[model samples]
Target: MSATGAAPRRFRHGLVVGKFYPPHAGHHALVEAAAARCAAVTVVVAPSRRESIPLDLRLAWLREVHAGTPWVRFVGRHDDHPVDYADPAVWDLHCAVFADALGGESVDAVFSSEAYGGELARRFGAVAVDVDPQRRAVPVSGTAVRADPAAHWRWLSAPVRAWLVRRVVVVGAESTGTTTMARALAERFRTAWVPEYGRELTARKLATLRRSRPDATVFDVTWDRDDFVEVVREQQAAEDAAARVSGPLLCCDTDARATALWEERYLGSSSAEVRAAARRPALYLLTDHEGVPFADDGLRDGEHLRAWMTGRFRVELAASGVPVVELRGTHEERLATAAAAVEDLLAAGWAFTEPLLPAH
Candidate 1:
């Protein structure tokens, strides 16, 4: 039987491709158009192409950029020929390879602005539709963002631009290597990272008393309420800084949720307000496995403290409502797990970006 004769009654799939460099409002319109025109849209974000954002950052940006559109998803690989697109022979090869991979998997139509899409569609036995809402070539082109990341952002839909503001935050008690793990994830993902806010306040101890605590001087400051609030403020400031300048994704070491956890540990209860302060992150990277012998840098007293801190930190952050990914094993293993999780989120058609800091 012919392939077309066996096809589903309703259009089963749609294929869309682009560099999607921090995909903006215009990109959103294109995907929405394709989704509306078909059953499902496969959004191939080709980070491998030149003039594209880094692969990990591209995946993160795509997730937050198209959060509400459930029909569209992301892929790392693609069939793209940026310079040779004008030559049909080369273009056809690009289409053949990409189309065979994506189109072979139940694709019934292809939606694109590229002129060669129609030829590829016929080869793949799918309908072809070209969509270009804004006809002006140069201004609407994605090349603008590659040249100036700051300027063309305003042209994007408010939500998509906001998703581009996201940063992944990892929270834990002192001695958990939160900063080290954060740096690893950032380096692995090729994005910015927020250092631990508590260390900036603490005199080395993961949870220590403050200078102004009238009850006592140093020793175990965990019970000090004033110190807890101070740490929370410190975390809040860090999260704010991360989101403001964050390009694609920000990996934060610790958040206010960790502060609330410390409060619960020493004070024996969590703060509703402090917990509320942790709603900024799109997702949390929680650590489950321990690594190497921890140093007693005055800050990291022992493994018991680290374990206690991890437990308290986990409960509080989970309660705060940010989605969390528990990382474990070696640095390579942990970051690899996180990288995979981030990519999966982008593939499922959800862009996870919260605007600025969530209002307390």
Candidate 2:
């Protein structure tokens, strides 16, 4: 304990470096443990040659995971890449860059399992403590997160776990089959989904509210448009709040644009009120895989009408501003594509219920 004299008093800073591609369970534990012991722990989300994950997203995951924590700070890139370690001294240069960031602030401890990490800590006058490389005590590591994200979600921060529950809302025209597609996505991703709330409500209220046909009685289909519009507006707002709060991502059956289309097509004009509500979902998905058999919702016209309705549906959704995923192909093909698309979306960060929960 005697360097100059009894190892001096413990420093307050703790420097922890990591890639944090997705900030899995193990990383959270490491961070939590470090934050507990250090006065301030600066997390450097290390840069990658393969930027499969962008710096901003990596930071976002860290921020989302550790949203409430006050001691954490993120720094991703360290000097330039590759470090030209052929020179051997390049490590010192790279290490200097990191130390400069610390600027006169010396860490009481440096935590890492990498071989060079201990030496690096010594250079900075740190107490170089090794976190279990085998993940025996704290199972947090960038590699583990990349390998099995879902299985080890409990290793992540509680806030990160909570942020994952959302239903991906899928929107499409009547008979374009959003219900089936949404269900398919849920099955494919093995998660809970929120069906088109408006459609379900509309299906029940079709008889009570009295909707006008698009081509009937001189093509004036606006009768009671406000009623349907209002109903959809309410349901959308509810689903949105739920999605943002506790989401596995809602698989929406239709967007407000669908209702807007119905109003414009059948009611002769669109509702400005409903259109405003359309901006809720972070993203809007529209199914364009046409020619699927129509279910004849009692309000539907005779054969070959679904294609026309779907076209009108697209025209309306295109204007809603939420990024769209237009699905196309035969019904089965479309469903498969939709499922794959959902998988991709989930990979890209779709919320789902029953996802991995964080451990204490």
Best by lDDT: 1
Which residues of candidate 2, in runs, are more than 4 Å off? Answer: 1-11, 48-50, 76-78, 83-88, 138-140, 147-171, 200-252, 255-305, 312-360
TM-score of each: 0.49, 0.60
Q: How far is candidate 2 from the true structure (C-alpha RMSD, Å)?
A: 8.8
How much is 239 displaced in model 1, in angstroms? Answer: 1.9
State how far residue 296 of model 2 sits from its true place (Å).
7.1
lDDT of each: 0.63, 0.61
Against the true structure, what is every candidate's RMSD? 15.8, 8.8
| lDDT (tens digit, per residue) of candidate 1 on 1-360 | 122334334457888876665576667676777777677788776533444346566666667667777777777665344435446676566666565546458677776766656765776677876666344542555655545444564565444444455567776655555688878767876666888666666554433343345354334534467677777787667666665555456788776766777677667887777766656667788876367456666544345677777776576666766778888788777778888877654444332222121123
lDDT of 1: 0.63
Candidate 2 structure quality by residue, lDDT tens digits, 1-360: 112223333448888876665676667666775676677888877655454556676677787767677877776663344544345576676676676666656677777655556666776677776555568776566555555445555565544544444345676656676778877766766655556555455444554444544334312222476665776766666555545443344566666666676666556777778666664454555666355666765644424545666677666656655556677777688777666665665567532222122123
